[model samples]
Target: MSVFSRFFPQAQVSLVHCEENQVILTAKNDKTAESEKRQIRLIDLAREATPATCNLNPLLFNGHLQTGWTTIKETTEIPIYYKRKIFEQEIPALAGQFAVDFVVPAYPKTTDPEATDEARKYTLPSGLPARTTFFSKEELAALPSNDTKPMLVALHGLTGGSHEVYLRAALAPLVLDETAGWEACVVNGRGCAQMKLSTPLLFNARATWDVRQVIKWLRKTFPNRPLFGIGFSLGANILVNYLGEEGENCLLNAAVICANPWNLDVTNIALRSTWLGAEVYSAHMAVSLVNLFNQHVDELTHHPRLNVDDMKDVKYIHEFDRAVQCALWGYPTEGAYHRDASSTDSLLAIRIPFLAINAEDDPISVKQAIPYDEFKQTPYGVLLTTSWGGHLGWFELGGCRWFTKPAANFLNLIAKTIDLSVTPMPEKDKEGLYGETLANGSIHKPSHPSVFYPVNRKLSMTIDN
Candidate 1:
């Protein structure tokens, strides 16, 4: 059947060489001018870039099928190998100071599976706990080998956190494995991952300060081990922006950005273009956003700029941003917020070895938004795109998610290749790409605020000891 033929979609990878702005193509179907490849061959580059074969499930054949199936599928397993410790981080934002959770790994004294059953018993309503074992600060520190492993700091997508099936499926195996010798910390954005946010401010695409704080804290806490970063969807956008903002001053040894909506403007348009995109994906996401807003309605309603009552009418994802993200962050409009928040411009500034993966058929993170030219210019960055794998869903022959294996392999390659002795540039010498004062004394904030709130400058931390 013609439909069955689509089950085995080939990978399409692209990377541009900055000099002369030359474009490189991988797949045979990629349309390029005959003059486009005067000196270089534009064919079959994906096979060399990724090892994973994209044999999509016969049942989940199309983009919408792959996307829908992956979300509802019950393949995500709770992490059972490691203990969890929640650290409360206080960071400054436009609205005020807010405390966010930094869920990290804490090891048990012994590997007796039955002994830690109660610890793993800590469960969420979703039945997939963000973490399995629970430990206090002192309790974690008391363990002999708790603090000496390599670190992987992860960030989840919109309205998602450590509990996300995609994240747990992709990350838990790599970090929780004792033989891998790695630990992970999921930086839960305010009001996400079941954390109750007190401040009116909710996280947006440009919310990188909290991530910066967590990364810096991790560096301070574990000065001896190497550090890596991986961000999914919205988290990927924030992580990339943070990497660009930090530039030479970022402490990450390597990073992975998966299913990143590189350009928010294109993504917004794509969501509203089709019936399925608008009715299903956008509507679903808007409801999730509204639900998150409802959880912190008590705190958010009191803000002078926010009309919490009116937020109930938000129908589209962009409308939700216009009502909430714009009001809280002081954006004049949703367009301005999307423009400032997009990571397209930030890709070229990144100096660390990183892999950027995307699906050509991602319904939400539309392929049109993929900055092919920008990625080509980024020397340390690699972009891998599959012809299938809708959004973050890459179900293979036996329902296996394909992206995780390649991601882990890429991170491992980076760990082996990079020099660990090198450290980030000194603070004074480096510059902040966002929320900083320019040389001419003009402050470059994320947006122009119509209403003023006390800017909380203090940074502090409280571990759930």
Candidate 2:
């Protein structure tokens, strides 16, 4: 003990030492030769530790380090754990499940270059007041004739409005990718009162019709280009359902659906509330429809969608379900509608390469409720589940970025599957997230641990009935 205790007192001196010349070499600076040597050693160690499949491209890294594309498609070995979140179906509507995913970002999260009113709305569909929004996309706009680019349709989630354009702006990030080659159009569900929607979301499932309308409109206007659809939550379900239900009527060749629920019935049962989920969704729809009715209530009592009388003292979802969804969509009851409107059950027969990603534990998108057996069997559709993405809220736990890699990778996977060329999530954004809600109606939720019911659980949810 005394022989080794001279200058190296309390030190083993055997593991990390050299007895050659008694000279010590210490790293002097971050970019010093020693530091660079250590960096190379660390890089080599990292490479040695990496899995066989994780192909780290030194060339790409060098390029990025030189050109600032640090967030490009860097390969990682983190295996995919399918996340699936399930939400109960709307009462009086079908039962289902919805999930959230970390799909890649094809759009730039910045102010979109195409967001400008490049042209103008010169005509109104169905002679409506050109109500600025609705539950899904509409093919009513004339595509920019002078320019020939693909169309990117975006659908907003529940309680959303044109008043706050951030949701739409977040999506702007997806379409901004130069390789995607598509223009974006944000959809306002007819159920909200804020965007001046043309109708009521009472026809929740029928929202697919509106999305199809938009696609059809785009095809007519842009005849030569391809159309892609991207929808969040309800919008996703609506678009997927339309593509599934319409089969060949859909003009879309590809689509990305995030944080969606299928099997309306199962989803309704998976919520934190008894029927509060359905009640909340339905009540919001009722109020929006009621507001629209109120706008012309005295003049159009016979329009036959939803009326001032049916909403009479309606409280729970089942009650409102009987009045609104049933009365509007021609269902005998909400129970019947729930059976007919489930999108999960309708996943088969979809000819397009549709991608559905959701979290396994989303409060709204219940995962176990999805018909996985069928999803796995579908050749035209793909279901990629994540472990923790919440509702379309896939932001990394503390940071904001959530949907970039997942979406980009999914798009790339599909491109490979379908033989198309494209890039991964935008290399420009290292910050940001993707997500949803429906029309304005009477619903409003600001941000946070989005508590579902009591209209105000610690004050996260709010809807004036």
Candidate 3:
């Protein structure tokens, strides 16, 4: 051992690194007990070796404490300037339209004659007047092509957007540092970050359609730039699903998914199983959902399928999904929606380098919900399960998120290793991720395209509830 290592021995940990064709395929006849045992084995063997270790503040060691405490913790001191850009997505929604807003770092302009530091003061521009200095589609289209610096596209957690403190904190270090030479944008979910819902819909776990359009627009607008994606919680789930659906055609060179709930069914079960999960976390989530729903009640009330009255008694997230998400997404039952929306199956089809960071002690996403075997078998997937970090709470000594530096480093590594000359061809299927086979054996197509078999190859089969 080296002298430094001998003096202060480094802590050791295990990690699951999935290589191509390295999966332990399960037989159809395998018993449930056997599967459970295999999952347990995977968990025991896998460990985290991330450079950014979770040395949380001594007072916030507990999973629940780490999660709950960080939400209210003061973290606005991080200096990062931001401006907004809205993409008019032509998806199926009210008035035949939808919108996605991206919060991009505001770098000091060297070319624009009128650019001022005051123009970059606002980190979030969602509620600002329509006539603000925010860049419009035309303005962004006219910008010079940038193939030199890497681009990081990020997504936030449940009911969160660019304005969220956790989102900004994770982004500050890379975007603010000129040496990093990295530019970033945060894709705000519909009706999030004080943005009004133009349609009768709110974003759900299965809401990959919105992200897909944003990514397409991004690629078209900023062609040839090295693009990477990083998502937290709900956004992670959406990004994973998008990757899986796109398969080799996915535009981003690499992706990082943090605190993702691989299986929504497991997440719902875990939440209701404990008093803290149900009363505190799930209940709080339900309140946020209800508030978002109330924001567009005028438009939503006219929707044919939505049971607006049913939303009144939503005390938990599942209930809110049943009342709102199920109807809008055409799910027959809440369980069905959760089953389909999950990114567990999506892991099988991801063609890019995928790094997933989860905390074993995360209370909301819960350790049990993580699809260890799926990640273990993914051809380019790496799972880093830390000993402690609750939900999105990975606070270090000075209130900075432990995952920020590591996430940026991983994206940078991918940019360096991958060939940036050729863009991967995307799968032609543009509908959705799931489809049904009728009794007659012909494929049944829904109003919203759901079933996707990646190009000519199928990675995994999704069971419809």
Task: List the pairs of residues colliding in candidate 3.
Answer: 14-47, 249-425, 249-426, 432-449, 432-450, 433-450, 434-450, 434-451, 435-451
Which pairs of residues have clashing backbones in candidate 1?
A: 16-376
Off by over 4 Å in 2: 1-143, 146-148, 159-170, 177-180, 191-202, 272-301, 304-307, 397-401, 412-465
Model 3 C-alpha lDDT per residue in residues 384-424, reported as the tens digit of each score: 87777788887766777777766676665556433444332
Query: How do the predictions measure up, each by TM-score?
Result: 0.76, 0.54, 0.77
Tens-digit lDDT track of model 2 for 1-465: 565333222201001111121111122244546335221121122122222221122232221121122123212222211111112223223222221111222332223223212111211222211113211112113223546455566665544432223234344344555566545565555533222222233336435544544556557666766567777766677776666644434467567776676765566555425454455444554564455445544433444566768767775445655776676556777766655666665565454556666656455657666567666444445566644444544432223334444444444333323322221111223111111122211223446454321111111211111
Which ten contiguous residues of candidate 1 have the minimum total lDDT?
456-465
What lDDT does candidate 1 reach at residue 410?
Answer: 65
Residue-wise lDDT of candidate 1 within 296-341, one digit each (tens)?
A: 7887887789987668679989999999988886788888888778
RMSD in angstroms, candidate 3? Answer: 10.6
Q: What is the C-alpha RMSD of each candidate to the true structure, in Å?
A: 9.7, 20.2, 10.6
- By lDDT, the best candidate is 1
Q: Better model by TM-score, 2 or 3?
A: 3
**Could you arrange the candidates by lDDT from highest to lowest?**
1, 3, 2
Model 2: what TM-score?
0.54
